[model samples]
Target: MPINTRRSARISVIGLRGIPDVLGGIETHCENLYPALIRDNPDLDITIFVRKSHTVTITNEYKGVKIRAVAAPQIFGVDALLHSLWCLLICAFSTRPDIVHIHGIGPAFFTPLARMLGLKTIITHHAQDYLRPKWGWKGRLFLRWGERMAALFANHIICVSAALERDFLKIYPSAARKTHIIRNAPSSIAGRQKPDNDVLKRLNLTPGRYILAAGRLEATKNYLFLMDAFKRAGLDDMKLVIAGTFVDSRPDYEEKLKKQVSENIILPGYQQSEKLTQLYKNAALFVHPSHMEGYGLVIAEALAAGLPVIASNLPVHREFLLPEKCLFDPDTINELVSMLKRPDYSYFLHPVAISAQKNDHWHRAGKEHMRIYRNLLPNSAILTPTTR
Candidate 1:
């Protein structure tokens, strides 16, 4: 596929520890979107900034996409922010991309610098980081300042969900016109075959009814609350399986959850895609009890897996999950319990829900990004021919 002259020029993505996603949302987004963007415009050069320590090998091209690695020691605590700063400096001098797409608040702080270097800056406001429980007062203050500055400085701001757009509008009302709401896509594994039983055996999970929750073991995920709610609801038959890596920021919080949870609760930690898919398929229900999400990708994943969902009553969850499919309300544990007790309605997990997921699929997300890139590029540049 040759690059479409009318689509894009050169785009550089910053943020995420780099792709082939060893972990996290932004990385997954990049892995999915970049390849699709390349498919859409073959000549549209894409470079992803990655940490040196990331062991994922990036071949010269994956369906005509490129990956660029930079040397940056991802320290235990300050890795994300530090890596962003390193990427900003590197991108500014080396790549000189026509469009610089920065993911999350960590990279948004560098938008102004990219703009100063004559790059068209686009920032994706992934979530309300300031509101997260892990950030202290000072950290929160810094995040607030960063969010405001990034919103004001970026040429365009992309909101992953409508809920995020609403939050952005509340603070940066005047810049609302510059904002774009492009929801996060479901994982590409949506319709893929379920993994073998060996995967479950490796995780020491027996074939039993269970509720699955997958995300970082952080405070904002509110797994502790979910555990308490499950206990209070007297859900003895169904075990709770939490799948995600532990973040050091909340070691005590993890310990607290472990101490409080019932014997049925299973912390299998982080399971790769094949194993995760097996878990999703085998589970009786999928629950996302996060305090906040810019876009609930896991909700979409659960829906795609044809599983009923019980999510936080947050606006983001409501934006995607249909009323019948979702039970929202963070305050009422009893309500969640009640929802969980209901029989699984197969109709709620129809193909329509899976098809609805295409709206946010990485291919569409990449095309939407290309549209933004075209809008920002010089008309003359759009007409230039390029090699396949």
Candidate 2:
């Protein structure tokens, strides 16, 4: 039997902790993608699988989307994978979706099982988990094997950046045709006006020049190095605001960073939508010193805010940052120091980059995803059968 295309199609997106409270890239991606789909095709039925921990429930129809929450543990360490696996199993039976779009490798581990039950599976390889430094040799090996399995089993493998696409080609050359490079977009608040001085005061920051870096406090992010670079630059007036919750991977890394930097350094922890937008607006520049990024979504957000960006010279960062708006080679502290000391910094701002970012908004990203979903449907019969 083939999928019915004449009638409205029902699509379910599995994996992730859920929405509203869910954090990080994949969760945010789902948040943006689902609503846009509803706006574009009102006839399309969308069901988002979320965790029980999510506080809000949508009983009313908003833009033709439905939300369903399943009971599952919400833990971050080793148990995070377990929690997602349980949610996937529950979603498998409860929601008989036409297409099950799994967010990351944690859910891809169960893709074969989903296929065994006669459902089409699409996995987005959001990041190369194997490259993360927190994982030990054994963990790295497991993730490497898991990624290969995901590529082999998933009906379609979505890579967020060209760098990731290139990586897939090298590791799994045969699956290159299955790989799709769809870049992630900025947050919904990207183009909004910068918040006023009152908002900055609430966040405990003076209305002055500052550099911003926001992400989880993990080793892969290389935040400590960011602090060192900022210190070496010796910007007395310009402060560096670091935001996001801390994990235990680097217990003393944060303390050491705080000790080294001048009193100007501010760590405000996690922030909500309005505050986050204000921070982006108030910043003179945004610096991402991460050693690895599948796709630098924050960089996109910075571009959207019309701020100059100085990111690591990683391949993924280069994919988004045009020549005018970006400063590569974050590892070189001296170069970063030079960038900080420049009196005339307005030249770093690029209107073209800002315009490009607005065009690549989340709504557009969701529409692109819908196109992929339509292409993958069995009734469409557009995709070639996999030989492997």
Candidate 3:
């Protein structure tokens, strides 16, 4: 490894499909986090590995961080496995990063190979990917195996939320010694950026007259439940806007959802940046019906935008300390419809849930990540050894 004038380490990040406007939670996390990292530590040379199928740009850089797009096939269950292997091979022969940070359990399967090639590995346990409904038995088994590989091989593991850390430790109890909760923050809201309402105006949506939900149209998100509830609620002239794209694994999900939507229900696929912020800030209520989430970052973002949020009764939602009334059981259409019918939403004005945004948490996340990176480096002094 050749030393640069000031930089001490080179880190390679993998597992998310391209970023800066990509659709997944992991993509958003990387988009916000890596930039903050290089901004704070000018000497760190970070190269992110993005899937060629998902990347839109030919550029090699993003906000001081080097972007290396790798060729990955556009298959659902196999893409991650192949992409990670390709990246690890590249790390071994080409770029030679001091550390390879693998995001998500699916990609963490290659951690052992990375270690075998003398590369330090850090795996961020974004979620219990095995538990997601998108995967079949084979996929589930593979993801679980990936978790085991990560537990046994990675030098350090970072879990996004404490609940997620708890869940992962339960499965791989011995891995607890090296695992740490670094947390995922909502987009910064120290002072709000001006909203872009171009899409809103085009869609004929008026502020406070619509209910907004944002996330991929997956079974775990329970979009069908939300749509059914909205129809049953039948609040006159109040529209429902679901601002997200479809999941690749669930192509039929779009057709199923389309059959149920009326003129008032909007499906503006994959909103981000100013458009997403506009939707968040202007909605009468922001709802997240996800049955499983690593850290309900979308809920936190809604809270940050000063929007009232109603969510499914997931542990992650409860982790936000939201009041009972704001959460509803997804199985019971009546309960959700009742929530939709509530005339006044001012009861949701609590600061406890919005704390992630109030604090510049992305900056904190970047610092914590740097500490872990430094501690793992050869002969580096940053933190003491982890206790079992």
Candidate 4:
């Protein structure tokens, strides 16, 4: 590869289904992160390869970043595998992107292919996919193999959480020198400035009269456990609004969840923009009951909305400085129930800590990402970090 300081560095992004209204954690991360990256560092050229099945847009640009739609399957396991491979082949055969940035472990497994094609690769380890219950033995093995390949092959690894980076280095100590931790920031709440509360009216919800839990509706989210805990909490007047979409691959889990939904337990399906922000703003208490997470982006969003949270005792929860009392074991329904009924929900929350820990995290993240891109392709004329 030749170094050319006159031209803007080109970054090719993969490992996500699609963006701009997409639901998953990686989708949300890309939607916020890339736009900010280009906004601050205008010289860098970023292009995301979207899966054709999830998105149908003809436009090739979003928020100044270039977009290229690639063919993708709708099957659960095969979809990600083939779509990612297809994109990699395009990179190998056609595109001359300076760096190929892959998000998530499932996609990261293909990093060796990108490297073999003479492309520089960066893997963003979103979470340990092998830990999720959705994967069978073979799937888990594949994910594990992917993790090892990424750790061994990629030019640099970017872990979303300190916990993720720490655990990764422990498993692949030889890869320590290449891995870095670039935290995922909370998404801005769009509903905060909405003119009307019509979305709440549609759901028949009153402000401060609901318990909110938002994420993809899957078994890994522990929604059933949360439903049971909320039932026993005895908040008869307060409704539990779980705002998320059901998984296409897991019909049995979604079917069982729907059967258990009573009048008080509302499954409003997947929501976004002002609707999602309104859900966050109007809710009394926010609950996150998940078995696994890389950085827990929704938990950060709930806090950013000034809503108190009750989350699982994952190390990522502690990373946010969530008090021990606010953290409950995912398996312990009784403990979550007890916390749910407490009158002093906000007392344990550290509102000051939120700003103190990370103020304008996305802006800083954009700058940090630019720094990384510069390091890899020094001749690309990337922006230098601005002084405060």
In order, candidate lDDTs are: 0.76, 0.73, 0.83, 0.84
Tens-digit per-residue lDDT, 256-300, candidate 4: 889878889999988876789888888888999999988899988
How do all models score by TM-score?
0.89, 0.87, 0.93, 0.94
Q: Candidate 3: which stretches are off by over 4 Å? A: 1-6, 188-194, 379-388
Q: Which ten contiguous residues of candidate 2 have the minimum total lDDT? A: 379-388
Off by over 4 Å in 2: 1-7, 53-64, 74-76, 193-198, 247-250, 254-262, 378-388
Off-target runs (Cα >4 Å) in candidate 4 are 1-5, 56-58, 190-192, 356-358, 378-388
Q: After superposition, how far is residue 382 of candidate 3 from its true place, in Å?
A: 9.7
Candidate 3 lDDT tens digits, 1-388: 3432333578999998887777888988998899999889877788999998887665699999899888988777888789989988999999888889999999998888899999999999888878878788999999999999999999999999888888889878998889999877787521346667597898889988999998878888888989888888987689999988885647687789878777788897777677888888788988888788898878878887877888988777787778787888878888888888888866656666666455546888999998889877654322234433
Q: Could you give the candidate ranking by TM-score, starting with the highest? A: 4, 3, 1, 2
Please give the RMSD to the true structure for each candidate, in Å. 3.5, 5.2, 4.5, 4.0
Clashing pairs in 3: none
- Tens digit per residue, CA lDDT, model 2, 137-249: 87777677768777888888888989988987798998877788888888776554554436568656664477889887777887877777777787887888887766435
Clashes of 3: 0
The TM-score of predicted model 3 comes to 0.93
Q: Which scores greater on lDDT, model 2 or model 4?
A: 4
lDDT of 3: 0.83
